[model samples]
Target: MNAKSLVVIGIFGIATPALAAAPTIDQLIANPPLLNAEMDRCKHLGMAANDDPRCQTAWKAENKRFFGNGVRYSPEPVNIFRNTPDKLVPAEKQQPIPPAPAGAPHG
Candidate 1:
């Protein structure tokens, strides 16, 4: 083989091990912080990221982390607004708003 070909082979032989040493998606997802950072990176990639395997894996991992085994957890509904009276809390037990001081500059 020519010297040029030998040099090219030598360079690839030295580089292949380094490339193999790179972590896989499972390894990256094992660490929560790393997974979160990867998710952020995927988010910044925007719509184009949907076609990226790394981004897809990161999103799936995040979904599993949040939703738990693909089952979505739906919490019971809560009524926070005062406009509607809540049946849960009895009106008698509810605290009454104290009357504003007489003639206090109206808001």
Candidate 2:
């Protein structure tokens, strides 16, 4: 009701969520952070934790849940190449190559 009570309530609300957001040892061990694409790819391969034994255990447990499971996933969420055959422009359609510079030997 009062400003002091309102402020205290608001502070507690924020603090409660902040506390919950903090990672527990169990969570940290189960889902170790991927430091880079290489690490993520390792996870994608079910490597779990190559460097950390704890993560390895967690990955083993997670892998067990998919016994006999055949995974179906795309390569990645990124541009695989500059252009594919369908998207490529033929050489003749492209701009002509610039003429060789003066005194420059032709290739």
Candidate 3:
């Protein structure tokens, strides 16, 4: 084989082992139990897990599992706290002032 062919073959040989060792998408998606276990472990890791690629990937998988592929299905929001009243209250009637005391001085 030519030197170029040998070099190409060597690169593929090294990469094939690495690719085989890495998890496939099907493997990732098919094992929710394993993913849950991984998520628990990541959770226990606390703040450190934020910097971890494995935890990040696991979180992405979890989000996709729950939310689906970026599509949102949110329902219209209802106004539960609205202050609609069944009936309006009318203002109380005011009593007429009695004629000022007859002897009171006029302004």
Candidate 4:
């Protein structure tokens, strides 16, 4: 083989692995561009987007793929003293100490 043919063959040999490693269609579809385009198109539809079946389906699919069902937020604040038994009750609510019994030997 000529030197040029050998160089071409060597280049192909190196490039073949890279081409083979490229993502498949399903994998590419999961990436940002495809989903982002769908979302952008839906956004362009404005209020009617909610009524569009295609937009709804795409939104649901994207939500499920990226976030599962949905995220839940608690309305109540977290109690930092929840696990501390001693600190559960406020100091103000505790009973006051009684006076000493009949002035028994005033110290």
TM-score of each: 0.44, 0.24, 0.43, 0.38
Tell me the tens digit of each residue's lDDT in model 4 across 1-107.
Answer: 99999999999998777533333334434786866776788899999999877677677667667665554667876676766674455667668798877856767
Tens digit per residue, CA lDDT, model 3, 1-107: 99999999999998777533434334556798878877898999999999987787788777777777763755865556679555569879999988976786779
Q: Can you list the residue pairs that collide in candidate 3? A: none
- In model 4, which regions exceed 4 Å deviation? 1-31, 69-83, 86-107
Write the residue-wise lDDT of candidate 2 on 16-101 in tens digits: 76533333334544554522333455566674357655445454544543342465666764566756653555575668789986
Ranking by lDDT: 3, 1, 4, 2
Q: Which of the predicted structures, 1 or 4, would earn the higher lDDT when compared with the native?
A: 1
- Can you write out model 1's per-residue Cα lDDT over 1-107, one digit (the tens) per residue? 99999999999998777543433556666788888887888889999889988787787777766666643555866666868855656556668899986886768
Off by over 4 Å in 1: 16-28, 70-107
Candidate 4 lDDT score relative to the true structure: 0.70
- At residue 31, give the lDDT of candidate 4: 80
Give residue 78's lDDT in candidate 2 (0 to 100).
55
Comparing 2 and 3 by TM-score, which wins? 3
